[model samples]
Target: MKLAIVGGGSTYTPELIDGFARLRDILPIGEIALIDPAEQRLELIAGLARRILARQGSPARVTTSTSVTSGVDGADAVLLQLRIGGQSARHRDETWPLECGCVGQETVGAGGLAKALRTVPVVLDIAEQVRASNPAAWLIDFTNPVGIVTRALQDAGHRAIGLCNVAIGFQRKFAAHLGVEPERIRLEHVGLNHLTWERGVTLLDEPDGESGREVLPELLDRFGERVAQDVRMPLTLLESLGVVPSYYLRYYYQHDAVVRELGARPSRAEEVAALERQLLALYANPSLNTKPELLAQRGGAFYSEAAVQLIAALLGTDGRSRTQVVTTRNDGILPQLPDAAVIEAPATVDAKGVRPLPQRPLPPLFAGLVAHVASYEELAVRAAVAGGRARVFDALLAHPLIGQLDLADQLTDRLIAHNHGYLSWA
Candidate 1:
């Protein structure tokens, strides 16, 4: 199979390459096209990718391209992982929001909205090119604000599926804590991307047929504190909610405190910017054939495994359906949101297509939050596709984090000002 990775210049590319090398038996990759405009960084990443494959004795042909059309041509699958305006833009996304007393996170709140506006247009353009090259090829999005991006792709009539590592990361953690294989632990992962909760932990040796021992209570009883620490939530809150919220929930459940903490520290974007520089230096070393340990701290843990599993199932390489967390159309999965709304939930994926499984009614607590965010996402997507200051302000006003008019107005101006170069309407 031929696979193309857009933004192959990113420091995160080697981790993906390592997964491709190790999982060749499951998903035999015959060729790799690394596409990036930054020719220097692209060469560094492609060199390490070739060396990693060579070390594994894999015969996959590695190629490089500075154009999306050339890189994705005739490829069976195209993976989108590009950043429109690199980490410097991310620094702005993470810091500017704190000035208005809001969470400065890239995947949630004001920062997430900024990323969606900047990313959606670029991703849509690339998707159009990928479709033009080979309409049959599947587009896998591993981008930020995945809910919005995936929604835009499906809206544009593109064959796309959104992937995130959060579910896999949770699965691995719960598996290690329970002394089971990660595959055996199926998460009852529900909600939108980056805004999900683990309501049930089912142990199933086979595919999720909606039948398994629900061990969430037991897992909490035995290892609640550790789980709380991992998610940065208080153990008492976990007991009260009777569910595990994504770590991103910290931004919502404790918005003011998070804003204070964000204001005090150098933004995460700053830390990652420095780390990427160091990682690029390492990638440039000809002797380096493996992903460095520091890459682990750079985040996106288990992303490669998640991407491989999703691709394998989608391409029928696994020869059977598998349940995995993905961002796809709601399709009435939750009665609270519109079917067109994109949500991150576990679904059965196979060659035929992805179908969201039926979900139990979300408790009022979770449902309210999910519905609120889903509404904001719809508006945010509209603003992203058809830009306007009023649209931006409306989306911000609808967000639970910035529902006040004054704050929304201020954030909208700042978002537009910081993102004017990318926003065509600005």
Candidate 2:
């Protein structure tokens, strides 16, 4: 099989390459195309990718390309990981929202909306090209604002599924705490990308199946403090909810505190920019044939394993339907959400397609927030696909984080101003 990674120039690419090398038996690839406009970075990543593959004695050929059309041509799967405006733009995304007293996160609030507007159009265009080149190819999106981007892809009728590392990261962490293998812990993870919760932890053998032994309560009881620290939430809150919320929830559950925290520190974008410099320097080392330890701090922890597992299951190479947390069409899995809404939930993936598994009803505490965010996401996709200042405002106003008309108005202006260069309709 042939695979192509758009934005393969990213510092995160090496982590992915390392996974492919280690898990080749699960998802064999005859070739890999690293697509990016940053030719120098592409060369550096591609060189390291080749070395990583060689160290494993795998014959998967690594190639670099500056053109998405050519890079994805005839590829079995196309992975989208590109950043539209790079970290400099991310710095803006993570900074400007604070001025409005909102959490300035890359995948939440006004900043996330800005990223959606900038990313959706490009992703759609690339999807179209992929369709032209290989209609059967799976477009795996690892892009931010995943719910919005994946909605756009599916809306356009492209074969796409969105992947994020949060669910897998949690699974691994929970498994370690339980002194069990990661595969034995099946997370009852629900909600949209980044905004999800672990409702249960079932110790099971298969990736997707009936609940084995319900162990979430026990795990929470024993390791509540550790889990709380991982999610950056208070143990009291965890005790109240009976579920572990993603760290992103902190932006909502404690918006004012997050705003103050962000204001007091450098934007995460700035920190990542510095880390990328160090990572690139490491990548430049000819002797370096493996992903560096510093790359782990660069974030996207367990990304490689998640990607490999999902791709393997998607391609039917895993030899059975696999349940993995992915962002895909709702398809009635969550009655609270429309079928067309893209949600991050556990789904059975196979060569035929992805099917969201049945889920218990979410109580008002979770469902209300899910519905509210789903509404905002709908408007967010609209503002992204068919641009207008009013649409952007409506989406922001709909967001729980920016419900006030005045704040939404201010944020809309700031978003367009900061991202006008990337938004054609601005």
Candidate 3:
């Protein structure tokens, strides 16, 4: 089989590369391709990927391409790790929403919509290229604004999987909270990308094995404080939910939640600069190992992500295990959202491909929490694929931040302008 990374120069490439290299023992061998527009960074990351492969003495082919068509042609899997306009654009994405009196945050409310508008077309073009070049390729997207872009691809009828490592990551935290081995815990959850839930959990082998037996103590105040200030964001949401969430939370904390929390909002520019400086500096720093170490380090974090490993565990050679997955479809899963809306949950995968677990009703707390966000995600998908002002307006109004402003019309005008060229409005 073959594997390709669409935005190969990504700062996170090494994590996945390192991840796959270690998996050589379990999965079949294959060639790998790296595609990126940033020539220097692409070459650097490619070189690192190759060196790592060579060091491990793995026979996986490593090729570099400036074009997605060439990179993904005839591939088994395509990993999309794209960040359009890089740091410069992300700064605007993070800062603008707050200026408009909306909770300016990343990957959730208005901030994400702005990013989604600019990102959808580029990602759609990439999806089209993947479809044309390799019809059977499964696009494993790890991009941010993941919910929006993935929905666009699904709406356009492309084969893709929006994989987030959050589930397993949170499972570990929850397991710790409940004093159980992470692996033994079984779960069911539903929500958008970074924002999610822990509806239930159980020991795999225990009798009368239900959640009522496990007692969860309180940690919200402490957890909330930890997540709110740190740049490693996502911790705050975990604290907020009374579960330790995965990913960074500093960006998520500055939103309307600031008002919800203490009525004090920090400077937006300061928030944007945190990640901006890190990525720009990483790119600037010459220490980025462009040698064999790159591949060695690539994908080092996947053990925890468990998306591919979970698929492998359930479907590959030792086939039979299963888990929850996020799937798009308004269907029986969530009564509030449309039947075609994409929802995240546990799934089963094997040689037969993926099957969404039977739809489980979301709890009132989480259901009410994510309802508007889910609406934004669904509407954003329509805006990207259908490209009408109505869809854009719907997406804008559907967001918690925008709705809080009660100026959906104004927010809609601004968002449309922010993402003006990313769509095909008539």
Candidate 4:
């Protein structure tokens, strides 16, 4: 199989290379094309990718390119990981929203809407090129504002699926606490992209074998402190909700506190920018083939595994009806949201494509929030595709985080002014 990574120059590429080398048996990739406009970074990362493959004694050949058309041509799967304006733009997204007293996140609040407006057009253009190159090739998106981006691609009639590592990260953590392999844990993760919860964690491959022994409560009881700390939520909240919220939920569950906290610390984008510099220097080392430990700090934990597994399943290399969490169009999976909205949930993946598993209706508390966010996502997509200040304002107004008309107006103006270059239609 030939796989192309769009943002192959990113510091996170090495972690993906490591996964490809280690999990070769699962996907058996024959070639990898690293596609990026940053030639120097791409060359450095490509060298490391080759070295890692060689050290693992894998026959997969690694290549680098600045042309998406040439790089993705004939590839079996194309992975989207590009950031529209890099971390510098992300810093703006993270910092500017706080000025409006809204959560300064890249994929949730006004900032996320800003990112979507900047990102969707570029992603669609790339998807068009991929289709022209290889109509059969699957598009695996790991881009931010995934729920919105994925919906755009699907609506445009592209074969695409969005991926996030949150569920896998949770699974790994839960597995460790249960003293079991990660594969044995099955998470009933449900919601739209960043707004999700692990309602149930069943032991799938264990002796109990699909008996549906939910371990979420046990995990909360035994490892509540650790989990709570990681998510930055009060343990009591978990006890009260009876479900573990995704770390992204912190911006919502504790909005005022998060605003205060964000005001006090440097934005996450700043920290990642510094870390990326260190990672690039390490990648330039000729002797360094294995991924540096610092790469873990770069985030997207287990991303490579999720991508490989999903790609394998999509191509029918893995015949098992693997229940994996992914973002795809909602075809009545939620029953509460529009069928066109993209949602993140556990789905059975195979050669036919992803099929979202039936889920119990979300409780009113969670349903209301999911529906509210889904409305924002819908408007965000429209605003992104059909660029107009009014569309942008309406989307912001619909967002639960920025419902006030005046605040919505402020956010819309800031978003357009900051991202005007990327919004050609505006």
TM-score between model 2 and native: 0.98
Question: How well does candidate 1 score on lDDT at residue 379?
Answer: 93
Q: How much lDDT does candidate 2 score? A: 0.92
Compare candidates 1 and 4 on lDDT and give the better one.
1
Question: Where does candidate 1 stray beyond 4 Å?
Answer: 205-211
Candidate 1 lDDT for residue 418? 97
Candidate 2 lDDT over 260-350, as tens digits, reads: 9999999999999999999999999999998899998989998889999888988888687788899999989899889999999988888
Model 4 local distance difference test score: 0.91
Worst 10 residues of 3 by lDDT: 291-300
Give per-model TM-scores: 0.98, 0.98, 0.79, 0.98
Residue pairs in clash, model 1 = none
* Worst ten in a row by lDDT for model 4: 204-213
Cα lDDT tens digits for candidate 3, 1-426: 677888888766766666666667655447888899888888766766766666666788788899888888888778788777665666556556655666555565666776777777888889899888778777777776877777788878887667776666556665665566776676665666666655455555652243434332232443445433322445434555554433433234445555343225544435444643455455454445332333323332443246455435433545554564554444566787776566677766665666667756766766775676777787877776667777777888777556543576776676677666555673
> In model 4, what is the error at residue 409, expressed in angstroms?
0.7
lDDT of each: 0.92, 0.92, 0.63, 0.91
| TM-score winner, 3 or 4 | 4
